[model samples]
Target: MKRAWSPGAVYVEFSSDPRDWPSVGVALLVLVGMGAALVLSFLVFDERRFGCMSGIEIGKTLVQVALRQLAQLASKNDEQLHREREELALQWSAELKAAVPQAVAYLESRVDDLDARIAELSSDPQLRRVYTNFNFEAHREAIDERRRMLAHAAAGLINPEITVERKARVERTLRALDPADILMLHGANLVPGRMRGESLLGTPSGGDDNPGRMRADLLLGTPSGDVLASSGCVRMQVSGGGAGQGVWTEVFITQLGLDVLTALRTYTQNRKLSFVVPGREYKETDRTEEAARKILAALPGLGDLVSWSTRRSSQVERLYDRPRPTRGFAVLRFRMCQWQDWKLRLENLIPIYDKAEVNLVVSAEVQARSRDAKREVFVAQFNGPHDLLRYPADDCEALWT
Candidate 1:
């Protein structure tokens, strides 16, 4: 096949912007007649498909092939763009779709920060304080003196004068002993228990507790064992000081105190640790005849309403078997009015005076009928040491009797 240039004129006028300052946009423009050789150069022969020719058929086919390639390129570009969009959607919603850990990485990072903060706070030594509010520095003098006296007393119990065999036996006993062996403050050293089954408070039966008793229930039961052994209270406290220090309270720790005393009695058999208490009776007492006078004086007067029947025994004494506080408290019958400086005072005291000397107990009653007067009063009581923060005699009769 032979191809010829059709009757068509090709025209072009190159233009330039004045801003570019090009004096000429088209360097050359010419119109020339195509010779037969230029036409033949592109001549397409049907017999030869791969030959280089500038024929109209070849040029048309070339243009058609380029257009097809352009269409394919456009399709490929569209496919690539679609893939890119899908990949972006996957990156954003992977957590919502597949539940991958990376999806929650941002939230997990914040959670990790909180856990680290908690761990740091728990590990800080300042936060693990076992004892607080002793005013250790303020009363160092008195405390030091008391500590010295206790050291002396302890030394006397394990005196050097004792034979070596006896000392060894005592040491062995001490090693095996626990809190229960103590008669008073017996197992005061409430350190953690060791791997060996022997408890720090050391008694095997340390956790047994009784429930019928109210005061007996406030004790703490830890893994190591029980402390503050409960004993039925003997005396009632009158009043106490400080906030939450109310009177009309009961102190339940006879069992614990007795345990501590028992341990002491065992340790210091030969040497006795006897100290004068205000009202408690111990095994050792001076049998002076003057004591008889004191006892008689302390006795109730004849037909006196105050001294009618002092004999008292607890009914549910057995509930204090395991020795723990009620994990609770009771309200006092008598309370101080807002006008009083000592807002709440204990109407009763359990004068331990030795072990857990005095506790700030409080009790409250919405309506307490005055014994001496025909009036209902709101009453609260606390337990602790109290001084003159006194009420007038007439007021006591009228308000609390």
Candidate 2:
């Protein structure tokens, strides 16, 4: 179809065929050009009108971003600083913890060293004397005051009206004082006596007999008080006495008397004097051979085989001479038998056997005297295998004999 167009009027042509239409490429190009132009225009207008405002907003946004970054950096810095502070504090605490014990130990060691040095210095005789003199001079008043107090307490202790509890306390205080001081406060009487002689009063071998003797003289013109006696026999080295006939006496006094005399003597700077009681005397005798004989006599069939001999070596040799068919055990039990009816069991026997020849040389020492001369006797008993000895030996002998 052909279409005519006027200058002022538009002419239109309709066709159902696509070939009659404009090229799609050209139409698209035109439309793209129009859209591009429109966009370009709008961009130009926008650039002219709001370009500064947009720049201001961008600047504001940049400022806000910078501020946030700065704030974050500041927060990080603060956190880092806090962490560093914490670390420093922890480090300091650790250092202190580590150093404190060392310091204390060092101080203690120093103190100990100082004390040791002081002690070493004090050990010198000259230093010790100086210290003693200084101490005596410095504490003289204090010592005097203490002595006065002690004296007051001691005087109060003797007061009859004082309470028992108070007196007890005072007495304790007085005890703490020098014993010489106490003795000087209270007067004491001294009585002297001599030991005349000693006798064998009774024998323990007989019934109802006394076993020991005590010789003491009665004190005269002295207060009724405690008794004190000297220990052992005191030999007085005085003139006009022979060597064997030297004056020997035991002074018996009350216990209080002893204390008072001891205190006075010490206060007066007297020589050492014995103030204890004499111990009982004991005498013993050996009766080994006699006991062996008695024991051999008591045995049933041993009377002929074992003979009593004064020498122990012969008896021991005789025991070994017998034929030892079988291994036999032999025991010799020795004991002290009292003459009185009372018999005490023996302990600790010397073991002897046919195989043990060394034990034959061993001998027991016997006492020569006993406290009771008539009563105590050494007894011996034998125990062995039945094949060794036909009879058991039970015998006794006087230790002195």
Candidate 3:
């Protein structure tokens, strides 16, 4: 079926809807024209629109380039900073190394100065004396402590139940000990042997005659007028008596003897064993007859009595006329009268007897001039028989005159 086409009406065609095709062709043509116009418009406005966007793109590119350059610059600056830090650290280390030897030298110099000062102090005499005193005090203290320990041990060994062999051993130990070690054992003060007159006898005497025996007389103070206790051996006797009448004390002077004597003396002094008499007890007795003979014998008028005959002549002299006296009885009477007058004169010139006494004194002093000096001083007095003196007789003339 075909339909006719009208301007405003519907038309039908039989050739497969030919009327619809013309309308379709017109719509296509209209669409084709619109597409051509759209293409043309795009071609014209594209350049102008893109030109506006070109500036924004270029700006973005420039910004990216700047950012890259800044990053490179920042990397270089970090490297420079690291290098400077390393250099500074090295400079500080070098300075510290350079100062080390100088600092060491300065410390060494200070130490040397201190050493010199110590040496100087050591050489000073006063300081040396002080050190010596300190050492002596320390040594003394140690000795005292040792003495105490030894005493305690000795006390333990002194038990009654102990064996005789052990007792002997302990006794031997004590005997072998030094004197100074046991000085304070008995709690008795003792004087040093050096301080005593132990060295007064220069050489030791020899022979069986004991010199220390004479010291006993000095120690005991036995009254015997003619006895002389001297260091050397010189025989002397009393004028009127035999050798037996004079009490002689022999001494053998030796170092060991002297030391023993000193110890004895110290012991005796501490014990107060010497005999003492009151001053009033000492009296002068009349012995003019006996003293006269001695005075007459010592007179210058008597020549040296070297021989027995000379000594006899000095005692008695005879006055005889060249011509034998006609009367022997008259000569005898004259001699008797002369003898009596001489005896009276001799008695007036001499003292017959003497009174002797012993004196003792003890003193102590501290030297004011010394610095840190010991304040204690020990002194003792021991007098002998020779120290006695005769009382002057009222009738007698002075011997010197």
Candidate 4:
């Protein structure tokens, strides 16, 4: 057999011999059966792979199905997320709506108070300066009732009496103090005191030089019952005792302290709190004053110490050295001989010495008029034989004279 290829067909040539014919006939039959088998195989395989659809059509269908399923899954997931988000928003909205009105009302009442204050200030021409000077923004968040009332009362004071600068300072000071610090002034006396020192070289107890004992008086009495020597409310004096020969400390309320206390007392009276009015009750049982008198009586002094309750007392003129006059506490004076005896007696007076030191004042320098200045001022205790005087003492001033 021979074969040639045309554009689309195959040509075959066979030998004319009968032997060749029979072989050729058998080969032809085999070729036809093989071609038929191949056709059948193609049809069966097409049915199995694509289920009667063409390859391209089947591929398109698969892509559509995948896209449709993905879209459905995304839509379901989005709906689930949306439902959860909506539920949370509804809960939060309900809670906020229920609570917001009460918060708004409370804030509105505060605004109304501010408005009333503004109206009151504007009505008085004299208070216009205070209105202008007051820093509302700085004090906007101030919530303490006592402090707020104090500030209002302080502002209501006539203007010329309190200069613009001083008023501004007082306002700032008012806000700076803790409520307890302000309240503590109720126990402190207005008897302006000082802290002073003297040379202990010539004194009898000077030889026993212990620095700790020298300044022990500073810790004797604190207003807050703490070790603080001076709060900003009180003035502080320099404690000078080169290498601890002798040191004195005293406590006195500041002008600002006095003003704040007075204002709070005056304005906050009807309210919940009030300041203690210092007089008969405060002076009568005052621990420091009582202790001083007990200590003085026990001491082996020169003569009987005179206490003049009234200016017209019969013994007033006899005292060539006048005793100091203070506003809130009693005054006692001890002479040089008296100081010596007092020192000797202090060791034996265990009751007064060992008692808790409350209202026992330290000292500081202040304006002369602000304090009681006199000769023979009350001396609490003389550390040595020399002299223990308050700050701003005269030269060689006797301890108590």
User: Using lDDT as the measure, which candidate wins?
Assistant: 4
Query: lDDT per residue, candidate 1, 1-401, as tens digits?
Result: 11245468544344455643342422221111132334436656555674655566565565566558669999999999888666543443432233223223322322335345445644644332211111121122233333222222222222222333332333333332333333223222211112234322232312221111122122232221232322221222333345554333332334324322322332333233232211112234333435433433442221121121111111100000111143322111233223132222221212321233223343444454467776544443333211110111111211110
Clashes of 4: 10
What is the Å distance of residue 105 in model 1 from its true position? 12
lDDT of 4 by residue, 1-401 (tens): 66698999998788887768877998887775565555445543545667778756765555565558669999999999888666644543443344334333322332335445445645766455544434342234344443344444444343223344555555566555544455455445322222245322333333322122222332234344241233355654545467755655444456766655544443333333234422112334334544544544444322232221111222121211212232323223332222333344444543443452423232211122225654332233322111111211211122222
Q: Candidate 2: lDDT over CA atoms?
A: 0.34
Q: lDDT of candidate 3 vs native?
A: 0.32
Alpha-carbon lDDT, every model: 0.30, 0.34, 0.32, 0.41
* Model 1 regions lying over 4 Å from their true place: 1-47, 50-54, 95-401
What lDDT is reached at residue 201 by model 4?
Answer: 30
- Top of the candidates by TM-score: 4
* lDDT digits (tens) for residues 146-167 of candidate 2: 3333333322221222234433
Task: Give a tens-digit lDDT track for model 3, residues 1-401.
Answer: 44576789987443456657776676666665565555445544445545666755644544555558669999999999888666654543443344334333322332335345444644656544433432333233324433333333332221223343443343333333333323321111111111133231242222111233333333324322122123111222222135345344432233322222222222222232223221112225433445544543543211121121112222322221111133211110011111333344333322321121222111112223236764322211111121121211101111110
Q: What is the Å distance of residue 234 in model 1 from its true position?
A: 74
TM-score of 1: 0.15
- Higher TM-score: candidate 1 or 2? 2
